[model samples]
Target: MTHRQVMEALSGLLLGLFVAVLSSTVVSNALPHILTDLHGGQSAYTWVITATLLTLTASTPIWGKLSDLASKKLLLQIALAIYIASSALAGLSQNTGELIACRALQGIGAGGVTALAQICLAAMVPPRERGRYSGYFGAVFALATIGGPLIGGVIVDTSWLGWRWCFYVGIPFALAAILVVQRTLKLPVVRRTVRIDYLGALAITGAVSLLMIWITLAGKNYAWLSWQTAAMVGGGLLLGALAVVIERRAAEPIIPPDLFRYRTVALAALASVLVGVGMYGATTFLSQYFQLARAKSPTMAGLMTLPMILGLALASTVAGRLITRYGKWKAYLVCGTLLLAIGFGLLGTARADTDYGLLSVYMAITGIGLGLTMQNLVLAVQNTVPRNELGAASSVVTFFRTMGGAMGVSALGALMTNKVGHYLAENLAAAHIPAGRAVAGGGIPDLHKLPAQVVPLVTDAFGHGVGMVFLCAAPFALLAFVTVLFIRETALKTDQQG
Candidate 1:
């Protein structure tokens, strides 16, 4: 494909990518409202998000494996179609369970979009020229990231539009992407007899599900050190061990184990996990922080996050262009990780009375680090591996990152719940308030319904918990920095290797 043809195809592809990313995040501001309406508690709230992420993580390798054997364009369309159907159905869900089920279905399509977008793009552009085009990819991601929250907030806050519209809003955009791709994307199909590793896929899925369940329920449903915890941890590890064995023996492995033999791929995968942990864990509760702790409206919460989005947009686009121009990426990775650590370190000081100006700066710093790190990590892996292995290699990095995000959210959420419970109990006892106070509800706290004296204490507890979450995230960022230091820099390839 020529430059003009690639860009034309990418036009449709970026839109498709945008829709996938938008659907994933558009619920951030609306989640509180959704859970409240469905009568869900804190665990339910975390699972709603975790369910989607878990499916996306588990299915990514399967989608990537199929991309190598099937028609890329056909697979892309099928994924989009699934997304459209699931999103529409999710809007009609009457309860949290239904919504979580729909979200899991939605994740099946998302897994394809997230992996195949890069795979399709790599087929069209060489690693060298990919940097120039990658800037556009970064821009699209930034746009989706920025737009999702704002749109979700607006829909959530609007009485008539409501949170349901957040699900419905992306359907048209997804449909449009399908049409555009059908017309514009022209890739040569490589037909081959595909042998999918079903056992490996199932094993990995079981492992991930068990691990996530353990993380979500450990401190709440059972003691972290109890027999239930031991059983879950043992089961998850046993399943993970089974997955490795299956992958090694499979005719065509879902995730090719040999790819990890490459030092750069191994290091990059590690870095991706750490980065995902810090990024997702720290940012997941920020909206709640703004709305619940600071008592801001949904729209106001989204608007307040603008500085972070702006920094992300600017850094990703700029970093991509510069990397393309200079053909050097190590500095950006190192600097970005350092900035990420510092960002989380500063954010750890957050309190109910934290200054907006200072918080914005911390968020922007973290955003800039993410913008530099997220896309570039995949690009680095793509540069080192063979094109035929692109699907597996790319998905491996993405798979771990998504797993990290799922784990981070579950762990941090459980931590916050315990911390909040402890803090609330302490404050209530000091104030001579009973344990049955309205503010003691475990789910999304409705501040307006609480007694005047209880509201401040509840908000302060949340603020303190959020601060601890960020503090816990800081060490992960530093670990990412250390891992990036060991990744050997390889020059970007100028010719397509496939």
Candidate 2:
């Protein structure tokens, strides 16, 4: 590819990747309002997110395979179209179920965008110069992540727009992304009637979905140790084992068994899993903490979160550059992991009484550590793998990280609800409200309309529950630190030849 060709194609890829990241995150601050206004409950909230993450995880590897077989540009446009259409449907939905279903469809599109963008970039850029460009992609990732909440906040707080606009707002961007890729993106054409590993894909999806469903439902529908957990988790594990058996024997596995043979891939995957655990679990809940516990409006909550985005932006760029310059990555990975653990542990202490400045400091530290660690982990894995396996390697690391986040969000969310529910029940009983009414079917209260006396109690209860989540999360961060320590330092490759 010529300079102009590569640059234009990469620009489109970055834009697509940026918008995909934006879709998942921008909805964070707006979710409580959006669901409540639709008369939905906590279950709706979980499904809305779970559906998207499920589809994203299941379809990502398939997209990577498709990009390897066909024209990347054509595949991207198709993905963008899917995202735009589903996003519009999601915005127009009248009920939680419809919104959840539509969001799943949107996630399928997003899965394609993420996988294809990275693979296409690898196809064009050599490994040596890839680090410099990787920094730019990292910046794009961080920027969208930061921008999503701020934009969501403004839209939700706008009287004329409200929460629906969160979905609608992306439609124009999706359209523009599609058009840009169509016009500027180019790739080598490959013609092949390659059959996908349909059975392997189905097995992996079924296994993952079953387990995630079980996790999402447990504690609420049944106890954590109930028969349902045993059945689903156990069955899920069995299916996963079968998937491994099949993939090892198949001609082409959706996730090849041999990729894990390299120790670096294993460690990077573990580190990614850790970052996902802390980043997704803690950052998402922070919005709830601020808006609900601190009595901040959605707009103000998003604004307050500016520190995290700022930190992410700074670290992603600077870390990428530093890696490019020094040719050493292990120290940064180790340091970033340690910092992430510290940040999350500190954030565990935040409560209603915590000052905004202190809160910002904790979140900034978390964001900085995450920004330094996440993308570089992928780079480390990519460097270790051969060019032919680039798509699979990248998607494998990305898939595992997202899987970690999915599980963390589900597990931690249940923990939060249970803890908060317990607190509210005790305090409400002390305040003479019936325990039954306090724990209502949903453990949700209409804050705007509640009796003045009950609001503080409820808010404090939520804060109490959330503060405990980070404490639970701290050990996982340490596990990640340990994993990163085992990754031996490797020189950064500056050339593009895979």
Per-residue lDDT of model 2, residues 1-498, tens digit only: 776788887888888998888888788888878877887776676677778878888888777766666787888889989999999999998988899999999999998898888887777776555666677887888788778888888898889988888998888888888888888877667756766787888888889888888888898898889889999999899889988888888777888789999999988887777777777786678878887788877778878887777787788788777777777777777877887888888888987778888988988987788777877787888888887778788888777777777777777887888888888877888899865544356734567766777788788887888888887888888899899889877776656555
- What's the lDDT for candidate 2? 0.80
| Model 1: per-residue Cα lDDT over 1-498, one tens digit each | 878999899998999999988987788878888888999888887888888889989999998889889899999999999999999999999999999999999988988888888889888888888887877888898788789888999999899898999999999999999999999998888878967999999999999999999999997899999999999999999999999999999989998889999999999999988988887775578887888889888788888888777888889899988988889888889989999999998888998899999999999998898888888898899999998888888898889898889888999889988987888788889989996884546777888888898898888888888888888899999999999999999889989864
- How accurate locally, in lDDT, is each candidate? 0.88, 0.80
- The superposed Cα distance between candidate 1 and the true structure at residue 130, in angstroms, equals 1.0
Best by TM-score: 1
How far off is residue 226 in model 1, in Å?
1.2
Residue 272 displacement in candidate 1 (angstroms): 1.1
Model 2 residue 281 lDDT score: 80
Candidate 2 regions off by >4 Å?
1-6, 435-439
Poorest lDDT segment (10 consecutive residues) of candidate 1:
435-444
Q: List the residue pairs that clash in candidate 2.
A: 126-496, 127-495, 127-496, 128-494, 128-495, 128-496
